[model samples]
Target: LDRNATMKTRLTTLTWRGSASVDPRFSAAMLPWSIADIRNHESYVTLSVGVEDGVLAAYNTDFELQFEHKLRYILGYCRVIVKQEKGKKNADFLMPKATSTRPQPITIGNDNVAEIFGPEFGLVYLLKNPHDPLLHIHFYECEKYEQVGWVSFLIKAMELGKCKPSRH
Candidate 1:
């Protein structure tokens, strides 16, 4: 075999075996068994849209969805306040003003609070920022966050081959 092909085979063989130096008890979850088949150059994996939706539902709670809905509602009517300074250049630029409609108090659902899984942060429910996709708020334990779930652009991450477990 050529040098590149030989190196690839060796790497795949080593990855198929559990680590030599580490005990199984100390390790976290193992890579899904499909990794072996997926390593083949001609291999392809097919996932159904319904299965994808179901998995998303399993990780998301009703409260969290409601929270996102309310935030979206408030932001829909939001506008930036631009005050013109006396001596500033381009101070006359027109800006959107807040709606005249009275602002009502937003009452969120019970899931508005974080579910504590540990002494400090056991579970982590992330709220994604509307303006920035990469930013999010963690609701539960920082150390044990993944025990609950993670917020990520799964499709984007997988497309870029960057979807490994972040903490581990």
Candidate 2:
């Protein structure tokens, strides 16, 4: 496991100001190792580019609130796996097939994820075709962590920006 994946990846400092600016608290309180470990799970996803980490919700989307008027649903962990015994090229990444009737797997193409967002906990992942680098999303459930992280991330962004943002 790469250690950086576990640590927080955000930070605020003169050196860090050039990248995208989200809440900096996420970067500050995190131990470097915890952010690093995340790479093995999620954070490797890069599509056409310009995509933010959280998937946007929509109108009547009972999951997240995207618009002031429309309902929004947030996107969570989406992974591609391969199954070893499935007789497919990347069979090992697949979730096991049921011996009898069971809930079917949720497998979607890479480009279509943005269109479909569902209850993160209720979502299921199945086998991926296993390329050298597959996109993965890791959803962390600690709002406390997010609150702390965002606060830290912002604080650092301000300080680094020379705005000298202060919280009391």
Candidate 3:
């Protein structure tokens, strides 16, 4: 049995499911995570990222607008996991399979940055910057994936220019 395969199966088992009612209190608590704040170019986006034992995980909610002209809303969770390799000073990212029926092991090394973006859930950028020496993650919520993609592209372009100094 492959290690990555086993890890993927284990992660799928940790799926969270539940239901709740809409209330003004709940809405008030989540207002900070709204797409409007991201659109306004907020300086900081708050997300929960933590490490326990040998596993590092980040979790966030994706708001999906439904019904006619965004009258209704649905919520889903996106989780990213990275497991430390035994005896090695590197970790492997665990990418979730698109569907529950198929189990595919997709893992990336720590050196490579991993990002997940969706039309509903927003974007998660995972990277370690040398200047900070800590895990740097930038999350942005958008009603449409196109908006996230556009911003991501611009950020990447700017980063490239900064790295090369003459590529602009």
Candidate 4:
């Protein structure tokens, strides 16, 4: 098999599991009541990379699909605004706590995708397409633990996605 075929196989089968937590600083600023909340409050999450409906996709827990973007090598440079999944609540709270301000969108490039995973308040990811100038994925997390493994998995996913066959 060619290299692209191998990469496509790996990307479609890649899966990683880990827990997410709120960053103490962000939590203190936004959800002061949760300051005492234990790290990794969400317990566990599973993320995967795959192709759906002919587009490269990222799947969150329970096989729920998130962002979909074209492969950079196939589509050339482009820009896509990563949006939150509909109906997905941020954190476990019934409603967002009252705050003077709302969360802001974070802009990231291919090189900075991993940084999003390390933030204290939000979960962010980079879409597989490197040519996208504004590609990013963002979500809320109170605290995160076992991030080293998560990062490793994500990096591998990104590498695999880069080499995925264009025909898919």
Candidate 5:
């Protein structure tokens, strides 16, 4: 194989094995996962419509989708927020424990919230400046996960601050 092809194969090999590192110990309660997929050259990932904390993040970027799997869980959690309040209207997510406008050197504040929409998780952590506001609602041309019994768990998290699915 050519050098580029070899590198691509190696990268895929590494990327495909990423699920091995998922730690069930550390608290992934707050942020589900970082849908940062850098190896996808064919199919694209996407996020549904929703607001995170207070920031208005709604866009599509390739790598963002990789993180979508994680973010989607969070958003799915939000849906739980809505359901738990069934006889209610608005749902408020606890502010983030930290934030940053410059990516690195993340500061501390609830003003920072991230979101993924459209074909991927377009991260927008700052709420004051208002970066992007177009959550391309139709990024995934195909359905990824069936948004069924998944939402209830999120509601359970809102009430408890962490997702604790009742083990049967």
Candidate 6:
């Protein structure tokens, strides 16, 4: 359970609308550590994403949109999952088999969209193996599996515990 896997990794922050900003409300919310502390070696991450109504876009580090296009259907929901590199020698990361079967979808709507163009949710990732730090966020078309946009993140171990550890 204490094994360390070696691989070349690059972690970057997703820049949205010229800055890496999270919904203040989402950031201010609390995490339920009591529920999380039950499992040994378990950790979690809260992801905040912004979904736009038109022209799904991907941006480069310069704060410029790299890819933008209108999809056939409107984005309805998304899923966040913990992923790990396929092998020590492989650069590709894969979502675990167990997670593939029962991923909870994160949905944005009129009720939850707190502000115009500022819809957000606290997408939580309950990591299967606490040491492996990666996340895949995939958005899909309304009522369908048509992917609209996606982002991947490789969390640095040092940044994992920025929050004060639970006293439990």
Task: Please tell me which predicted candidate would have the highest TM-score against the true structure.
Answer: 3
Off by over 4 Å in 2: 1-73, 86-88, 91-96, 106-168
For each candidate, what TM-score against the reference?
0.17, 0.19, 0.28, 0.26, 0.19, 0.21
Distance (Å) between predicted and true CA of 44, model 2?
12
TM-score (C-alpha, index-matched) for candidate 5: 0.19
Model 5 agreement with the true structure over 1-168: per-residue lDDT tens digits: 233321111111001212112222322232223222221324433432222222122223332323322233322222111212455533332222334543322222222222222232122211111233322111222222223122222333333546332221
Candidate 3 local lDDT, 13-83, one digit each (tens)? 11111112233233222322332333345344332222222232333323111111110111222223322
User: Candidate 1, residues 1-168: lDDT per residue as tens digits?
Assistant: 233321111110001111112222321111111112223334222211100211221111111211111122111111111233574422221222225464322212132321211122222122234454342222211223232223223322332456542221
Q: lDDT per residue, candidate 2, 18-39, as tens digits?
A: 1121222332122122223432
Candidate 1, residue 36: how far the Cα is off, in Å: 44
Worst 10 residues of 1 by lDDT: 9-18
Model 3 weakest 10-residue run by lDDT: 65-74
Please identify model 5 stretches exceeding 4 Å from their true place.
1-21, 26-42, 46-48, 51-110, 114-121, 124-168
lDDT of all predictions:
0.22, 0.24, 0.30, 0.35, 0.25, 0.24
Cα lDDT, model 2, residue 34: 29
| lDDT string, candidate 6, 1-168, tens digits | 211111112212332212111222322121222112222233222222222332234434443444443322221222222222463221222222323566222333323321111112112222222232332122211111111122211111112332221221
Better of 3 and 6 by lDDT: 3
Give residue 118's lDDT in candidate 1 (0 to 100). 19
TM-score of 2: 0.19
